[model samples]
Target: MTEDSASMAITLSEQDKTTLRIAAYGSVTLLSAAGAAGGSPHKIATTGSIALGSATGLVGHVLAEYPKSKELNGRSVADIADRVLPALTAAMSLLKEQAPEEAENFRSTVITAIESATHHGQPGPVVADMIRKITKALDAA
Candidate 1:
């Protein structure tokens, strides 16, 4: 994060931070699950997560602090999506309201993560669909 952006006086509660983390990391998890059929789930998660770790600005600061794994929902793609997709939209809305400047940063961070996750190989229809849904949710805000 640049010194200026890092010092931006944005306010966010713990709940809001958790929401952003879940939305971003859970996005990678969802992609991992979707690509499990004939893809490297580990690689999908690793790259996406790494991309998130590379985020800049307030989004970067929030994302750098990992969420409690146990707090993340879902054992399946559908279940996870139910929790994460809304979180994705909610996260966007929260950022737009609480930190309007960081809103685009958050969106770009998630998309970069998604692209990193899928760029490992030819993403199948399932992965592609997941990406579309994620993008939709992010835009829903």
Candidate 2:
């Protein structure tokens, strides 16, 4: 039992290190994606926030795809849902201040719908809406 416990600790530590490394690389990808999304037409501040949010969303998507991380490895679906929902919420908050009011409202509704569906354990609607919004947003950029 002692040996097994030590091995698990080592594995967890390695997983944490890997997650951090991936997260750092992911952050760079996010920054690039956001900058590409925020072309020259937007207000400088608005573009910056959207760029940040876009990067964050990209990072969240990537992290969520990973099967395990020290923080998320054994968490329940609800716990995962809890973490997933907030990224979108935070993105919406940043976007609301920067995006057109109507566009911001639509994105917020889309995120809320996704979160509600995830909470209910039927996430198809939420995912579909999210994908739709992402496609639209990307195309508009």
- The TM-score leader among the candidates is 1
lDDT for each candidate structure: 0.89, 0.34
* Model 2 Cα shift for residue 13 (angstroms): 28
TM-scores for the candidates: 0.93, 0.25
lDDT of 2 by residue, 1-141 (tens): 553233233222344434322322222222223233334212322332333343223232322333344543223434433443343444444334343332343344333322332343332443444345443432342
| Candidate 2 C-alpha error for residue 107, in Å | 2.5
Candidate 2 lDDT:
0.34
Off by over 4 Å in 2: 1-74, 101-141
Cα displacement (angstroms), candidate 1, residue 76, comes to: 1.6
Q: Could you tell me how far off, in angstroms, the CA of residue 65 lies in candidate 2 after the best superposition?
A: 12
Separately for all candidates shown, the number of backbone clashes (residues 3 or more apart, or on different chains) is 0, 0
